[model samples]
Target: MQLASNKGLTARNDNPLFWSLRNAFVRGDTNGLDRELRYSFQSFLLRNKFSKSVTASHKKLADLRYPYDWFPATRAMQRTIHLHVGPTNSGKTYHALKALENAETGIYAGPLRLLAHEVFARFTAKGKPCALITGEEQRIPEGTDRYFASCTVEMAPLNKRVDVAVIDEIQMIADQERGWAWTQAVLGLQARELHLCGEERAVDIIKAMCARMGDKCIVHTYKRLNPLRTMQESLQGDFRKLEKGDCVVSFTRIGLHTLKAGIEKITGRRCAVVYGSLPPETRAQQAALFNDPNNDYDFIVASDAIGMGLNLEIKRVIFEAVTKYDGGGHRVLTVPEVRQIGGRAGRYRTAAQDIKDNHTDTTSRPTSKNAPAGMPASAGLVTTLDDEDLGVVQAAFTSEAEPIKAAGILPPTFIIEQFYSYFSEDTPLSFVLARMREMAKLSEEFQMCSIVPLMEVADLIQEFPMSIQDRLIFLTAPANFHGTGQKQVLKVLARCISENRTAHLLDIEGLDLDILDIERGAADVNNTQYLQRLEELHKSITLYLWLSYRYQGVLTSQHLAFHVKSLVEEKIKDFLDNLSFTVEGRKAKRQQTRLLVERHRKLEEKILGDEPSNEAELVQEGPGAWSEEGHEEALMEDEAEAEDPVGLPDAIREVVSDDRLPRPAGEDVRT
Candidate 1:
């Protein structure tokens, strides 16, 4: 019977333990059965233990599970926290707003007036009391606990009270022209929670800053919602095969228009264009037309200005040229610029499916006979634009004139030092101190002066042989500082100045110069007879010095030996009305001076007030807070009358004030 039971167990595909237990039971041995059952259970336990260990090892290799040591701390911190950090089109703005919708009070600080207006409209649509504040506009809702301010850093003080403050495009904090405002906002904004959004490179810097401030900082990276597909071949061939909904990106305005015209000719559809020089309304209209799926415009020709934040429904992107003429010289495209523009190729909603089918070839060969080797090839994605030579120009205006030395590139240290030499030795170190005095002097003397003198100086400096000219070139060389067409225009201007000819600035409004060959273009310029006249003028020391000061290598080059002569043949009129100290009698002269000063003050006010055209004058308000009594009353009433649904306890309320909120308890969120 035991043998039969064991045989039955074996036939059922049971384990050896099952057969052992079955034989014990069949023998009617209680103690044996107990022993066999315990042994069988012990074997099952050992198998489970081995299986668990293997599963755990796999999880560790895959990083599928948090470590036992780290999970508890991470999980606790993850509960009340939110993060906003990513490249453009990564839904940073969307996620931040979602968090704001749940918060009791929220504030959004945007970079531009127009952006602030857009955000104001969005919040207003949600039935929230929102405010829009820019240098040109301000619409603050009275007494509302929640507010939205789309203001630069200068306006940060106005948004003193808020639960959460979101700083969009935190990368602007490093901007040369307006970085101070962003930096001030980050350091000075008084909010319980700060949410920053920008490029990934800015993450570590922001985290470090937050950590120094003793705030807990957390970083979150969001993958690109839409990634561009690779080009099968380079984009150097015939572009007729370009599908519908393609964007042809160009650097120069002329190039943009030329491509738009060419695309329209080929596709039989009107092409839209968005460039920096275009009016805001025109750019917005073009953006809308290009984004519209059913619109007659099937293509867009744009500059890098369209590379950020502008949403487009595009299937392909064509880079007509990879290089752009930065004001100082030609520069190659950086990875961020390429990624920003190329990232627009596929639509965010259908990236995976659409990107595969939309893959086009991008080739890099010598351009065709008519095309110039416009600029250097792009340095691939992830390459930083923070070259040391470039950093010198960025930090030039500061007191610390860090000498920029780069291999293969000319050092701009001597050039910058020469330019700064214009200031007196006693000059203050602060830009603000210098600016205040300059503004006061300008207001007293040249308040109504025409811009022609400044323009002339800029022109002469372009031809100037002094090293300072090189400094100016380096200063304006960056892609963002100057337009892509600036290099060609500057070269033409320099050639004209060298020949001593009156060079008429080309009006680019409707010109199609991009199609012209560079060699042919140079030949045409030489044929104008202006070159001969300019060369003759260059022999004079005055003209030579003017050119030297404006151009960099001219004065330093050993091949060029030119003496400095006064260039001003015509008497240069001083813009300022100089005050004279002498008079026939001392008392009479003093009285005359006092009367003149008062008269000048009134004239200044009237001139400044009337200077704007009718359209611009429409929104002018007398300088003051300029708010009506009724507005203030309404604000007070709105704040005093509102009900507090949260019934926030005294413990929290004590820390909250009219101008600032209580600081948040959780780890600080860094972009």
Candidate 2:
């Protein structure tokens, strides 16, 4: 029987039935494995003509254990994958977009409404069906496979299935108030695959958390596209000497305006302006004017807002100040902020390409005679924020609850996760909970009369959740302390917030030491003035803190009552102070003060009234010379006119401009 079995096994190995069985095993077909194995044995007996020896071999095969019985074959299947880590320029969004191009359905989630519009246009250009969903606008397409848009992540519906979801600027997950929204989006997104993009530090934390949650996380790091071209020497003398295409980056609105005026005065060339206060449409228009290839504008005077979104064709970036008021005090720019603004210079591809060609042909070409001063080495300068004592004061005004989650908007799980992200082992969850309890007690004791409604306040606190409320409390509590050395600091904050007044209250020379003392807790205090200042500062701080916690819904007049009172007190005090003189002096002061008082009263009334003022006034007047007749003709002189196609190097300038370039066959022209 043994000899017969060996012969049968050898014969079966060469049979077609046995070959089919083996193929089934290799392909990981479980049902096919069992069926084919049985068939192979039976077929072998029949093919060998069923002799006594073959029959005996079949009997022995039946007695022997089959490989299928020991191990079952299983197929490998594709699983949805998510990537959630990267810095600003790391191409995290780029990678996700690439995937979206191939996916049956995909969505690109952006943080801002403007960003959503930009992405929607980008995806639409790519010949993909896209939609925009922002708080201001929602445009959903019927039966669309992909969504290129922006929405408050917390408010976005999760029921819709997507093949892949890309969440841009995921670091917003740590935002004090709105962090909950991002956190919810990260946790609740139902896409088969998820992708997150943002700064490296924030991404690292997110990636770690995702790993802990059993989701696959991948990280991509990218250096800034344009690094600062550090100068061997600093720029000296007047800023008017700054060549065309230079960007003058100032910290303050006044500084930006002054720099623009100074540049125009010296160069006799009009400068374009871009800053935060300007509308998005205006900012875009200004950026375009500065970046125009026709070179219409000579210089751009801008604030830090220029550091984001719109691309400017800048050759050099000049810093008017290195530090900015961050709503608390003067603080130095963070590494990321500095890098962002500096990166704007030398980013103009057309300009950079030309510069590179000029450098390469310096020895061999005549064009090297005038290459525009080598484009100012693509460098930037840094300046210090003048008064450091005001940094904390500035922070106090701006320090409000970040609106991590809009009330009634985010999921419970997301709110919980957001709270968890803030605590390390050092700070216990119980401490945070305790703070929330204290806040609750305060709210109950100082509850506004029911005439206005208590439900609104309760709803506001409920909307923020305990974690967010406690965080705001902690952030603003430091400014509420009293002491002799802290008198000036407390008074400055109180005056600034209560009156909406920003003046040079502290000496610039002593600012650094004062700031250090406050931060170090080394300042001493025991005066009534200091205590009174602290009390006033505390009220302002508390108002901001409460507003931050309850700012999700439509704002009510009661909510703004304290702010109005503060403004009124500030105006009244100014009026009284200005009238402390002779009768004639007092009368003149009174007239001026009365006009201001009336304006303030009108503003207050407008705030309370259904109709708010929407007045538009010219921010800056053109020069008297420009206002005269032939100004346009004079300004048009020395203009490059039209770009000389032949003047541009062959390698740098294509026969057709990028806009007119012919598309490759089979490539999507929409994109």
Candidate 3:
């Protein structure tokens, strides 16, 4: 009672509940004390209502409903938006890029690094001063000050003003995992003319956004140059009937290699394989081999990586299955996926080819828009390997995809930092992220992106004594914890950061030149541990490169990391070239699933205790506590979704632009 009085605790409206309760207690009035306690409880509840309890800072951080307002410069501009809406192989991107090519100053933001690389190559070949920027690398041409910039969407410059900007694959605004990048680009890019190229499905949503911005919107509809037709009959799982120009699509890396082997065995022609896990350069090489008419490579075995506008000289698309395992479980392919992948079958005159031909034609030879000069256009054909998948493919092509309703957004680092300031210094980063998610305020037009991956990273680096800003940097790194060697590499880097020591390429354990040396190739690619190690090593090097750009001095071996990355990629390519694996239907899947379950069981056992397990502590205490060796089976089956490629945050952007080292929080903002 005395303590309560000192703290100015009292009842409302002269009720004197605290005093009454004290009086009751002193007089031994049990009923009065109970009544006073109930009244006091009600008073406390009324006083500490949700609205009253929430601080102004908490409300400010949670109110992410108006993302447009975040970019004041972009919002101030009255921009012109050109919506180039069409299906694949429709030359939609061609017209948009043409405008960009002619512009004095421009930027082309694409979804994939491959696309950015392609644009950079095209512009460089044309002798245009262009710069390429992606999460992994940046290549700036000599004697240029941003005349043209080709970058992954996340890396698009929001602060710099450009005359024209092209945001390719605008339909990705609805993508669950990476939609926020597209959204950020669309909402934040400072451009006089913005070209948005994508499917017709994104038209309304984009128009709605433009209307909200009070910008003039122009829609340009495009038709495919080559007609696409769904075949009436399936291949009936017959590899012998597969044609030379056919592209067989499968979901898994193992499945891709198995299909390649099976197709080669029956057809007696070399098959080039492409999948997501493979490096982009390797995939491009495989595509080039399949495209070259003089080469013995005829058929191409690929994953959905081809769906992302990978221009291959494919005559027909044969779907091995209409479903894929998306982290959680098997789900039917969406209309957009089916359309995008199937659309790659026969690109009569791709944007790149068109640009090349036009540039080389010194005699000014005129060519038809639909087909190149003296070349007959081929129609794209779609079919299924098995009889049951045909209907699914047909239905997906004919049906319309649902219109995108909302754009994905993440709580910016500054907002996160503001929220973190309210918590104790000892509070776990994961706890702060969880609380933010719980208290998030979103409107119907916007949705918060999944921060589960961030939470996982936070948990991994929880024991490290690092600043909030440094921790955010790691959390945003392109490290999927479940990836084969990613967790191991991340742990090493985190320890170095915590200890304020520079991390060298040699500091990483179990990764050496001997490990990456693939003299020949694996006999069995499907279940081989060596091939898995190479892939893991490739990812590890890529992660290092990504970190190198952000923590320049801290991760000091960018040159060595790039060299090792190339070596790993070459080894992987060699492995693919010599692989001759035979797999029955879904045999590899079962094997991998079992292995993943067992490994996960073991991980659970290690972490299951009175308190949460410190992953960093485990790494320091145990040699291979988190090392994912011989778990190629788990690597093959239970790969987590790719982490969101974080772009240059406002603070990081300033440091990068200035070409200086990171400064203190007072001097420079948090990343």
lDDT of 3 by residue, 1-671 (tens): 45344654432212344434644332222333454465445445533334544656576787877777778899999999999998887778878988898888899998766677778877877888999887778887786676789997878988889999999888877654567778899999999999999989788879888887788999999887767889899987778877767898876665676678778887788999865445556766877787777778978987775676667778889888776554433345777888888998776544355565774221233222223223444667899987767998999888987777767678878788988887678877876775665556666666665555677788788888999999999877777543447787888888887887899998776454566544553354333556556666766787788888888878899998988887876766565555454434333343333333333334334433234221101001000111221101122433221111123234433443442335654331111
Scanning candidate 3 in windows of ten residues, the lowest lDDT window is: 616-625
Q: Each prediction's Cα lDDT score? A: 0.40, 0.40, 0.68
- Candidate 3 runs further than 4 Å off: 1-56, 274-289, 292-296, 359-377, 509-514, 517-528, 583-635, 638-671
TM-score of 3: 0.76
Ranking by TM-score: 3, 2, 1
Q: TM-scores, in order shown?
A: 0.41, 0.43, 0.76
TM-score of 1: 0.41
For model 2, how does the per-residue alpha-carbon lDDT over 1-671 read when each residue is reduced to its tens digit?
24223543312223424334433332222433554455445434434444676445434332211211111110011224454343223334555656666677766665444445555655665667777764323567678544544443433555566777777666545532245455556655666677766655465446544543456666666554333443433344345457677787765443455456656666788789766434345655776677664755888887654444334566666654444433212234545555455545654232223323532221121111112454333333322222321332233223332211111112233333344354453443333332221112111001111110111122223322244444333232222221233334334333333343432322211112222122111246322222233334433333333333333231133334344434433432232222211223212222332233334334334433443212211111111011111111011100111110113233223322233424465432111
Candidate 1: segments with Cα more than 4 A from true spot? 1-83, 101-106, 111-114, 124-129, 136-146, 152-159, 252-254, 275-284, 325-329, 349-671
Query: lDDT of candidate 3 vs native?
Result: 0.68
User: What is the number of backbone collisions in each predicted candidate, taken in the order shown?
Assistant: 26, 25, 0
Candidate 1 lDDT tens digits, 1-671: 35333443331123434434543443223444564465445445533433565544423332311112222322222122234666555666666755565566666765544345545655666667887664323578998755665553345552255667777766545442334345555655555667777666556556655543445666778765544344434433344555556676655443455456556665688878765434345656776676666668766776655454445556666665444433211233444455556655554422221233432212212112111133222211111111212222222212221111100111123322432454444322122111221222111101111111122233433443434444244232211101123334344445544455554222312122232222322444432222222212322222223334444343332123221111111101010001111112222222222333333334334433433221100010010011111000010111111111223334433332212223455411100
- lDDT score for residue 541 of model 2: 33
